[model samples]
Target: MSDFLSKFNGENYQEWVDEKDQKKEPKNPPQKETATTEKEVVETPKKEQAEPKNEAAKATKKDVAKKTADASQTTKSKQEQKPAVPDTAPKKNASVHPTNRAQVKQEQKTATPVTATKRASTEETEIDPTYQKKKKRKRILIGAGTALLCIILYVIYYNSVHVAMPDFTDKPVTDVTKWATKNKIELDLKQEFSTETDENVVISQEVAKNKKVKKGKTVSFTVSKGADPEEILKLPDFSKMDKGSVEKWIDENKANGMKVVLEFNDEIAKNKVIKFEIKDPNIVAAEYKRKDYATVYVSKGKEVFEKDISVPDFNGKTKAEVETWAKTNDIKMTYEEADSNEVEVDKIISQSIAANEKVAKHDEMSVTVSLGKAIVVPNFANFTPDEAASVPNLTVRVRKQFHGSVPFGGLIAQTIEPGARLTGKDETEVIVTYSEGAPFLKDYKGQVVGDLPRLFYEDYHSKGADINYTLAYVDSYETKGTVVSMSNFNEYVGMSYLVTISISKGNLDQPAGYSPKGKESLGDLEEE
Candidate 1:
């Protein structure tokens, strides 16, 4: 009964239930000893009082191990020696009921877990086979999943670091944008103008081709707006435009990158333009990347022409009158002379230009004037009658006359005198000599009067005159027969005049008596 009560100690309730339910199998038990039963039962309380709970747990395991060993030894020894039985059974106390023995046996069967109740609470439960297989499958699946995740991560990292950048040199901007976005890359887009590329085309990129880049890396790029969207210059027709207007346009547009050059043309007027020279002929709506040279060809005008002017007429006007008018009007005028019977002298004959003719400054003007008809008489002195009679375009006549030192029939003087201008109808005459003596009667002065005209009728005879000549002989202190006095000396006079003279007849022996001779009248000698 004591052992039975001891088995019902406080901690064995769960173990007792487990044993009744047969939830677990029992291990081999220890062999019993009559000698140790009372001592062991008493010593268990003392052992518990001395040791800690963990130490008691250790002691319990050791006790279990010793019981197992002792049971094994007892079994082995019983097999070897056929153990002897006790002489007789020891008697029990009379207080123990017979029914109690049966109950005790029953209790002993229920009490199989009393020893198990002392086992540690931390002990592992035995595994189920089916549950173990299921658990193994779950572990394998988890390990595989982890390994696959690692591989995926590695692949992503590799792509980010080792992937090559795409060529964007001529790619469209929108395509580049999409590529960048899908790759999760950062993009910096910039715009610029280009003449060699299409609009919105990529001109340049920051990242080089075939180079590795990380995901989300930044990229810078430039795009083209297709050949500079500059305004094409609509130039004026410079051929008709003046220089001043073209210069003004240049001044205004030079700030917009217009560069102007100048040239000259002869066909255009001065300060006017001929044409403009530009590199692009058909270009419109174009923009300039820099200043370009464009030429504006201007005109220098005709080199031969000076200025325009109006010419004046000079017909029927005198040269003097035209000269004065030309000086006033700043005209360049010159004069020429021409003879014409119909035109009056000093009158304008013709002019280079008609009236109201247009002309320019420094232009030449020529005028012609008329000179009247004129005639000059020919000289007839010192010529023979036949030579003087042969004067061109003149009738010639001669009068018999005496002239000094002139031979007979030689011309002495002329009527309608030499160098005297006349009309074509004027008559002409010449005084021709037919006698070889002095033209006038001889002077009888300071002569001895001895020499007399033996041939006075042949030479040096007195001509016709009005003067009465008295050939008187007188006595004087002069040579004999010398002329003493005369009404006129031997001088030239008109044939119509008369003359008187006196002769001295002094004797040569002494200056005494002079003789007188009878004087005769000399009539007009020309008639003679």
Candidate 2:
């Protein structure tokens, strides 16, 4: 059947021609005219079959032969009128047999639908004049839609990647720094002295607020550094200011080399400014800057009567009068007694500070008071040797004696009577004696043996019996001439008894050429 269709199509179907057949064939006719011709050919036989049998028999064989040739001529013209299909349309399996009606019917029933390319070509062949306008409109709409979609996606992506610049004016720099850190941006910070803006606050920004910016972009902003030191600052008139105001000013401006100095001034009152000067002598105090060195001198008031004072004459004045004068003048006075034949007793003889000599208040002064020509001896009874020896204008001599009534070491007697008065030109000597109680031999260990005899004699002698002691030397671990031991110490010995004592040689081993200085009685020892 396919072979029969191929043969039929090769002879009758001009629209399904291959490239080689198309090259040989003439241009085809309109598809509508060809379709009209095919319809007439198909219906002519139908018309003959539908006619009455007598009418069919009346037609002659010649008429039938002429009708068959006309039919052939009509079929060839229809083939010549077939419209050409585009080269892009499918051509395979497109042929059908015309004479085999049953085959044609079966093929038409099983044939694939017409391809869009072929349909389009057929439509184009009969297209109206407005078709190109409609097609151009559709193409323009598609291209515009594609471009709009791309722009929408780009906007979404751009918004996600970029950020808007924030307003930084009048805000703390810390805020700007924090925002920059969060956005992974770099900051180009500049400092400017602003009178209106506070320190560490942003004054201005290079980028305006709400403007788009990419991440990691470097932005420049200016931060305030408080007021301008050189422009806004002015030095105050320190000469007319008090110490407190000047000091406070110095403290506030000390970083700029301002200071205050205190000095003693006789004219200006205490704590008042005497003068002010800039450290650079060429720059006057009135034109000083915050960074200029300035000094304000404050007065410490007059020093009159603060230090120097005239010494008062104390000659021939009573001690009471001199002390009163010293107390009133705040002078330190030390008194001493001197025997004077000219001045009266208890009167000031002389003063260490000469008459009208200059001296400071509270300065020490030595004053000498006169004791009259008659020097009365003080009572030595119950007085120790040291107490007796401390008397002024008198020399004291000490001696020990045994007494039955006086306590041990108490004063016993003095050579001159206690009330005796003597006219002495110089220091008068007085001898006072102390009691040793009852005389007894004493332990002399660790005592110097050289004074033993004198001690015993003084202790025992009282215009009566005199005690004596004998001495012996020995090699011992004690200092030379020091007593190591003594005999008859615990006995009830009285005066005039002979007591034995041992003296150390200061070495355990005796030396060569050493002589035995044998035991000697007190009388012999004293004589030697």
Candidate 3:
């Protein structure tokens, strides 16, 4: 009996132990319960199994809790051990569960990539301010260089092949352009017509020589064309044809486009055509076209006929016979009386258009018939200045000059002698006496007494009149003082005597003085 009790107790104890072990196994509750129930259902075993399983589940939960607590402690300890961070820094060491921590770690790694990317981007954005400015300056330099190049090219092109044009005068437009081109100068042409000059000539221009101009620049010029040739056709020729023949010729020439005009000329022969002309008298003989009719002028041909006849020796011919002969020979005769008494009345002395010379048949001739001479008048003497001026066509002038010995207002010597024949045509000269002012008469008294007569005579000779005077005498003599003189004086000294002189007189109006011989003597004196 004792042994049986012992075995039963041992088995109960083993079962309890086994149940506890089973519960401790790392398995789910259902699986554990199913496994435990399948083994035995003893009352004591069942109760133990249920209790142990419940305890085992609780232990497992406790173990999980402990592990979480240990991890949190480790995180906290690490956070405490790490250096303190500023409030602005993110908390990287904050405690978290395994799965949550894994997510946070992954986020930090992703953020790191983003930060690195941003840093790289900032580094790439950094650029030098001066570098940007340099780039702009380079662009400006390029533009300026391009502009400079263009300007230089323009200057070079302007210098090469530049030309100045030539001056042209009176050159035609049609020909001037050609001339300019031939001379390697650019040409600009202007045209004009002138009545004063021939046609087709240049009149003006620009771009004178030695002046610079761009290549291909034109020089302007003016040109002229002469007056219209048609205007030359209107003129006419009316030479040497008689009135009737001229009319006939005009009619005939009109059919051939020639014009004719007629004008009377007294010097030309009557009823005859003109033979000489100014506008190319030989134009008709030149055989030019009728259109150039202005090239001709007409004039009457000069009369060349000549005739000669006897002069009738009119030296002794009577006036009636000479007049009859002159009429028959178409001669004009005229007569004038001679001052000489030699020639007889009604006799001819001279002829004009000298006899025996060939002359036109109707030409007029003149002759002078002679008549008996007549006595000529004698010359007048002692004419005064007023009397000398009375002659027809005679001029007189009076002048006074200083004479040492002559009295003021006194008559001087005559320029010509008295008692000469006076004539119609003669020129005379006169001289007049003069004296210093009456207050200066003392100068005349200084002269020697003997020279006083000569001095007075010389003063009288200077008077511009036909008169003679003799020195009277000195009335009172005072040294360095004038002497009183009379108009008519006699030989006397100290006391003056008045003397009267006779002068031949006849026609006192005649020129100052005349020669006694005649008109011939007066002429000889004038010659001398």
Candidate 4:
């Protein structure tokens, strides 16, 4: 039973031990907790370190998000703002986008600081747009200012360096510009020796000083250093002075610089001075002081004379007697065969010097008595046209008349009579007549229109025949040297013929026959 009681006690003791163990275990647990707390405390520093790092990472993330948000906000604000349009809008749309333009502008604005920072960081930086633009503008202004200053400096230098010159006229050289321009004259300067003006100065002027000259007119002046030699005096003009006055003037002016020389001139009247001369001739300088004398020439008046003297009849006088009478009365006589067949030969035909005129003592007298014979007339009829016209001092007249038998326009007879005594210097007249033959038609060819009829008559007249002729023109022809068609009355009736003849003796190579058109041909003719 003791055993049984021990077992119960053991159980009860174990139960009691269990209950105490629980209680004791709670206390150990507290000690273990304390140990755990100590272990945790030991690990707390590492955890603290990790927590601070995590908190720092979170804070950095928050700050980065704020910065991104701020940047996005700034971008959105900028996007919302419209760029101001320039007043002068582009005609065409610009190629750059507004955003790109704003970005470029923003980049420019931020470029300086960025560059500075970049320079600080990297030690090298690119130039900024603003700085570049300001530098470019400054350079441009400086260049422009430099150029302007250069121009101003050039002007100042030019003005300061100029020098004033003297007036041209007051200088040594004479100024001919004014004189030449004013007078419209051409100036020609010539060098000469003169005392009147300084060296190279104008000594004398042509056309006188201050005289108005026409354009292209010549003006001459002498420029010289010294004077010239004296000139000889010139002879005086005495064209209308009397002979005595001229001689007296020459004698009285002997001391002056002139000498008289004498020569006879038939053109000048007798006892008259024809011309004079200076004793010594030379070119004189300006302002020469000398008494100038002149030789004089005078004229003697015309010779005296009388006309109309009484004729001394030489009818009964011999040749010697007539010669004596002619010598005493200053008469000239010539004899020829008388025109009257009944008159005797050796008689005077005519006298040239008239009777009873006052005559000079040196007068020549001539007397001619007739030779007792009839002289044959010279055949002047066959003379050529020129020879016929050159009959000197002989007057001739031609006329047309009518004859019943001779050709109509033939020479009839002479008035003074051919082969008759030609008395004195009187002209002989010729009378021509026309024949009474029936009219023959003439070929009026090459006759001047105005002179056809007269020329036609003359053609036949020169043939020593006369005829009635009617002219007809075959064609309009030109007039040449003479008329070239006439009728022949002797034969070939009703037949037309051509003839050429000169109409008048005056027109036959006579000196005054035809008017000349030029001086070359008119030299032989008389002047009007």
Winner on lDDT between 1 and 2 is 2
Top lDDT model: 2
Query: Please, what are the lDDT tens digits per residue for candidate 4 over residues 1-528?
Result: 554333223122222222233333332212211111111100011112212111112223234334433443443343335232122222356676675776654443322221122122222212232533454587799999999999999877754543222233212444665645654556777777543454566665665533334566666666664333343323345665556666665454332343444544548877666765333356232322224544444434454346444556555345676767656756454444344243345566455554554445334445445544443333344443345444544444444433445554334453444555454333444332223343344444334456765755665554434534443443211223333333332243432344333221123343444544432332233233
Q: What TM-score does model 1 achieve against the real structure?
A: 0.21
Q: For residues 1-528, could you state the per-residue lDDT of candidate 2 as single tens digits?
A: 454344223222222222222343446632432233232221112222212122222333334334444544554453456553223323467653555656544333222111211222212112134534555687799999999999999999997778899898999999999999988879999998766777799999999999988887899999998655564246677678899988777555432466778887869999999997778989864566666776788998875455567777888889999888788888888999877789988888888879988876667888998877777888988467878888877788987766656767788789888877765454479999887776666666667877876776555554234567778898774558877667767554554577788888888764465544433332243365
Off by over 4 Å in 2: 1-130, 208-211, 228-232, 235-528
Q: What does the lDDT read for residue 193 in candidate 3?
A: 53
Per-residue lDDT over 111-178 for candidate 3, one digit per residue giving the tens place of the 0 to 100 score = 22222221222121122325434545877999999999999998878667665445556555666667
Write the number of the candidate with greater TM-score, choosing between 2 and 3: 2
Q: Give the TM-scores of the predictions, in the order they appear.
A: 0.21, 0.27, 0.21, 0.22
**Highest TM-score, which number?**
2
Assess each prediction's global lDDT (C-alpha) against the native: 0.56, 0.65, 0.44, 0.42
On the 0 to 100 scale, the lDDT of residue 461 in model 3 is 37
lDDT of 1 by residue, 327-425 (tens): 876677888776667778888989988888777654678898777543456766646566766776666675555554555565555666667655433
